[model samples]
Target chain A: MKKESISRIMSGIDDEYIKEAAAPVKKSGNIRRYITVAACIAVVIIAGIILSQADIISPSHFSSEGTTANESGGGDKKFPETATEGTAEAPLDSFITPGEEIDTELAIESVTRPKWEDMIIPMRYGEITLGEITYSSQCTEISSENILSKLGEAKMQGYDIYTDTYYTVTGEAYSVKSISTECAVAVRIDNGEEYFIYVNSWYEPEDLGDFISDLDLKNTVLFRKAFIDEYKHSDTASEHSQRVYADFDDKVIWDMLEDCLSAENTEYNHPYDRIGIETDMPLLGYKNISFCITPDGYIITNILNTQKCFFVGEQKFREFDEYLKNNVPYKEYNTVYELNPDGTIPGKGEDGQSTPGFNPDAPVQISPPYDPSQEEAMSNTQQSSSPEIPQDFIIEETTRTE
Target chain B: MDDSKIITLFFERSQNAVNELSEKYGRLCLQISVNILKNISDSEECVNDAYLALWNNIPPEVPDDLKTYLIKVVRNISLKRYHANTAVKRNSFYDAALSELEEVLTADVSSENEVLFKELSEKINTFLGGLSRENRTFFVCRYYYGDSIKAIAEKTGNTPHLVSVRLMRTREKLKEYLRKEELI
Candidate 1:
């Protein structure tokens, strides 16, 4: 078809559309712009304070036992032991300096590790079998098959379910955070005993890997290596050998929660939204702990509260997907909790110290009460509102039954 | 003045109706013409012709929306002028918008078939109704109004790159829709 015919046809579209498009674009006033800037600054400052309190930047946090390879009892792969005389290793340097005294302590102090390495939490490995997989939204259960079918129908009918005003998924168990045209997000949430797996069969594993990497799981969660021998005796031995698992440090998780809370002050929603997992592994300490990428290419998780809905754009999504596809930790791991021999968390006792000779298959304890101070902080952040702030997708507490 | 008042003036045969219409939507009308014709003199002439058409037509045919009716008149007149100018030497600006739409509307729509034209327009409108508010606005401003990427970016409060990328994606969706409808 000639281009002019198409243009002429476009001219005949509904008049309401033409009027709407022709309407003057609203411009923010100077005062409102200043307030937005001020609000963004306040959010950043508050985030910095909360993260500082959690010791996210301090290298001292990594110095704790079980964090380092040598301290964790790595035999052959252990770091080189320091000799009293700085012997053979320093022969070339020693000859160059001859009789000059070397400031060994200063030299050691000068060397530093990358900040992200310090963020990695060391963890032990194990597995937990999941029970039923349920799909839900707005605190009510929905047919997963039905939603998937409708999504396909919508695409075939030349309409988008993601853009549909009423098409929203918000819940605790397996909330559909993002419904992108290309893929969907299905996350697993364990309810203390059995796991409720919400698997999105349409989800591209490559995208899932990317979404998990975007969460920066390796930095925030403890990497654990499972005892392949133990799995060898069990029916799921091959599964264990093929997959890796990690336990997240609640401190980092809380930092992210606070970050999302502070996000309310910003005018525009930041593309990199935080994803929280909702798993109640006693080892996980918290009842909720997970995150997933939405079908709309946004990574959103409401593991903590439905009030935490945020969006990242397609470019950022693609970048994260590419990263996860390339990274080994994200590609190889399944994000399952590593259980101790007695089915208890190895370091779940007082001050994170292990309790010896625990009972196996004992009922897992529920998470402690939500910290009142944190709750108050979240409430305070949620209450802050401005006309300039567009997205206030705080799922009402009433909608969340659990 | 309200559209009703403007129409009442037109019905009463008052010349002030044209003046009121010009005052209310002159800039927008001129801009739409400029987008298509890309010539200030020709755009102004076409807008004036549209105002005369509105004045002559309003007494016999009272439009539900005066601004929308006036805009359509101006846009149609401007497009005619653009087509005429293209016969000699093409106006790249409006041609860019036409080419964009041409990507999806590949059906052989004969000019003689008014029914086919109306059908295509209705199908496009239905497709638009299903889009998100932002996507619909972006598509209309780009295709219908012949807006430049920078202009669309400014209107939507987004970067030019973002606006361009979104338009490209929307076009892809439109292509898919047309294929399903057997229009292309």
Candidate 2:
């Protein structure tokens, strides 16, 4: 019996058997395969659309080396036309485990992580000592100038300022994850209606610190006001700590509080952890607007009983007493700003005329060691419930062409 | 299940390892055998033999590629079966597969280089690597998988004539590649 030498060469089938195995199987029948083909086309189209809406998927690489790779005839195998000049990183080469064999090309493609580049959310991070007041200030969506300047001073004082694209960033009073690679921050935005991964790696992915700020922001007020503005807005009260509840309009306070939240798509549910009988709850949602303005002027829209004008003994305001009977977390009202508490309905003074607190000339300072209870609650309130960013900024497609 | 997980199951001496391996790669193994032998029952036996081979060899050789490892075993078993069967009756996809390459690749009766076949194989590999992905796939289906030209045509939605012509051109290319490499 003669031996065949070509059989030796045939043993090394360069075909991607692993890839073929990994591909979704379609063995129900021909009809199923046709449906799968249709479904795949739909997925590609949808991926293209949402891909355009955000900076995901590899970019449309224009190369001079475009060759017609369509084969004339043979078995059911397909290969993407891989341009050697393309900038899109191949999943195979981006990661390499330590001490793993580098020689074989056969088993490499299966282990690649889902594209890390897809998760980056371009965010500005800084190490600043502008005091705890900065948290509330930044929460108000005050101009970045105050923070930038303070950050600049902090930088001049030798603190590092980093601007990095994160898979995610969680801001309650401040960014929850200082390191983007540690874990994904699940942020709920669009009023807690959707979830998006804040760039994180449970596997400790490589940190590509791609940019550094050289701006001498020390001359700028970015640091001191990074969170809290150094300058008072025209809406501020001139009097010594004018009562914030009697001062700013409800909409103005709500909008200011709203500005700090990173817009996310997580569906917001009125977070109430009540274990009582279901019949005991009254309307269970959007009952009455309770208000507490933080010492630093951050408006807590729920009944805090801690602000300057803590109590308004109006009868009608007390009529909605059943809703406020249970001390549900105050932030739960964040979803119901439409039913704002009326100042006219809830009297502040016996001869209610106008409000105070807005002094254009005076800068508001919220001294720390104030409201430790609320601060503790803010820390414990799962960043999972908070918004990702103030608004969905149509982030430029980091990889793909829009 | 992951390849390492399956391998770990084997190391732990769990009987489930064989079940998982057979479940995952059974179709692939059967396809390789059926492509060569053309008999369903014979193909089934070949697949079982391939599994046994993998079950025995994996302790000594932990392959990075479980899928490829199984396919190689199935392919070798099927080839040995085909060669043994062909001495009596020259009937199978295996014969039809070798008949085409018999013209361009078979050793010349006049030539006497003992290492010529090994040299030819290395040269053929280099030659296939240089071809377009389509042409290389056709070559693999015919020689490696031992698929009939008509079956390849049906699968690829091409006429049998087109596949025949493509294969003929590829064989010509291989001859030239070997001659240029001085392996002929």
Name the top lDDT candidate: 1
Off by over 4 Å in 2: A1-9, A12-402, B87-89, B108-115, B154-159
- How much lDDT does each candidate structure score? 0.50, 0.40
Index of the highest-DockQ prediction: 1
List, residue by residue over B153-173, the lDDT tens digit for candidate 1: 788776576567567767876
Tell me model 2's lDDT, rounded to 2 decimals: 0.40
TM-score of chain B of each: 0.94, 0.86
TM-score of each: 0.46, 0.33
Q: Candidate 1 residues A1-402, lDDT tens each?
A: 876688778977898888888874533533444665698778767755664465433332111111222222332222223322222122112122223322334334534232222221111101111121112211122334423222111000111111111111112232232332222222222222222222322122112223232233334343232111112222211212122223334444334333332122112254433222344422122234445433344445433222223344455444433433333232121111333454444345444665553343443322233344475764354345311223211112111011
TM-score, predicted candidate 1 vs. hidden true structure: 0.46
For residue A375, model 1's alpha carbon misses the true position, in angstroms, by 36
lDDT of 2 by residue, A56-109 (tens): 333342112212211122122222233112122232221322222222222233
Q: Candidate 1: RMSD over Cα atoms?
A: 21.6
